[model samples]
Each structure stands twice: as structure tokens, then as C-alpha cells.
Target: MVWGRTEEGEQVPKEARVVFQPGAVWPEADVHADSCELVIVIDGTLEDENGTYPRGTRISAQRGTSHHPRSSGGCTLRVLYPDVVEVQRPAPPVAEGGA
Candidate 1:
């Protein structure tokens, strides 16, 4: 679901306050070729490819990248998306499993 809308009443490229219950995970990853995203863990733990991010941790997903966010013990997150799309594609494979 789209989060808060702008003063102009648009949901695209919006800011969101999301809550993940214990063991909850976001099924679809976010993908945008021209937009980056910012994720801030407000409480509990959030895990992703980079590793587990504890409360107060901040993460940024670069443009053309994607990630599935999961929380083992619940979490609150503040996120900024340039544009939240209906479809999310997996991130491109790495080179030789590195980077």
C-alpha cells in the first residue's frame, strides 16, 4: 500500500512509515532504474543482503538495485522512495558472486 501522500496528493515517489511484525518480511523487492531509496530502522532488527541492521541503522539502496527486507523480531522503518512501482524485479546477478 502507498504511504503518506504529498501536499499535491500524489503517492508516487513518496515517504512511508512502515511496521514489520516479528518475522515479517516484505515479499517483493523494490526496483527502480532511476531512483534510489533510503531505509531507516527505527526499532528491532531488519535484515537484508548487506547484513542485519539494528535499530537506528540507516541504509540506502542505489538506483537499479533491489532488496527484500525482513525483520526477525519486528521493526519500524522510515523509507523514502523516488517511485514505488507495482512490479519489483530481482537485482541483477553479481560478477563472480562478488559485489
Candidate 2:
């Protein structure tokens, strides 16, 4: 599945892990069209559809779902997206405190 690493001589994906900064996200939406996903926030915090994800938080979502994830104070995540898609959310509304 992934570039290299395979299991049982089959096309199984190898074990993988990665860390993303505040405004980063996973790409490669094509393959993720019908796959479930899992994301474990190992450290720090993140913003999602419901709210924020603190350390030790394990978030799960359905396949073909979408979300805009961001870590304001930085975070380290262990993510497993059976497939990956880039979900974009609208920017936050500007403050009315004048420029």
C-alpha cells in the first residue's frame, strides 16, 4: 500500500507514524474514499469539528467523512487513515476589535 514496507507478502501497509504541526493535514484523498480512520493525539492539543483534542485523546471517525483539524498549541498525533483525504474548513471569522 504505502511506498515500501508490506506485510505477509501481500499489499498490506507497513506500520507508520508521523507528527503534524498546527495547520498541517494529511493529503492523498483519492484512496480514502471509503475507508475508516483513527487519530490518537499523543501529545498537546488540536481543534476539530466537535472541539479540541488534548493529550491521550483518541479520536475516531467514519470512512468518507471529513474534518478540519488544527493544533493551536502544537501536537503530536498517531494517525491511521485507512485512506486519506484533504478536508478543508472555512477560515475563522475575523475579530471585530478593529485592525
Candidate 3:
């Protein structure tokens, strides 16, 4: 559950917490900018490309970084976002007279 943004107001998320069922994975792995996200494993196992994180493990993702989090045996996570609003990365410059 997210206690950051409500139905009204600034629409900025301050903090978030979630409980993942066994074999559950986050739906989106989109990159985020201008936001620092931290994930703490409360129980079970959390898996990422780097390795598998067990209980009491904490991972920090700084601004302009992204993470893909998943769990095999279920886990509880506590996340925080200093800046809830995400900034999109700028597109590459087009070539001169390119198709």
C-alpha cells in the first residue's frame, strides 16, 4: 500500500509497501528518473539480476536508475521514493534528413 499520494492533492508518492505472494513478480520494470527508490526485504526471498536477496536485505536505487524485482518464495518489501514524480529520459537527437 502506498501512503504517499491520495485521490487528490499533489499526487506524489512518499512511501510504499507491498507483500508479494510466492512466485510473484512486479508487473513493470520501467526506468525512473529524479527518484530514489529503496527496497527492504522483510521476509522470504527477493530475486534480481544481481542475485537473490533474503530477509533483512536492503537495496537502494538512486535517481535515474531502475530495478527489476521478483520473488520465488514470496516476500514483504518496504519501499521509499524521495521524489514520487518520475522524469522521462530525453530522446536521442535525430540525424540530419533521416527517414
* RMSD in order of candidates: 16.3, 17.1, 14.1
By summed lDDT, the worst window of 10 consecutive residues in model 1 runs over 1-10
* CA deviation > 4 Å runs, candidate 3: 1-10, 84-99
For 38-71, candidate 1 gives per-residue lDDT tens digits of 8889888899776999999999888778777888
Question: Considering every candidate listed, which one attains the maximal lDDT?
Answer: 1
Model 3 C-alpha RMSD vs. true structure (Å) is 14.1
Distance (Å) between predicted and true CA of 71, model 2? 0.6
Which of the two candidates, 2 or 3, achieves a greater lDDT against the reference? 3
- Supply the TM-score for candidate 2: 0.55
What does candidate 3's lDDT look like per residue over 1-99, in tens digits? 443442244455566677889989878873655467788888888997779999999988877776677888999888777666433447999789858
Stretches off by above 4 angstroms in model 2 are 1-15, 22-32, 82-99
lDDT of 2 at 67: 74
Q: What value of lDDT does candidate 2 attain over all alpha carbons?
A: 0.60
TM-score of every candidate relative to the true structure:
0.66, 0.55, 0.68
The candidate 2 region of ten consecutive residues with least summed lDDT is 1-10
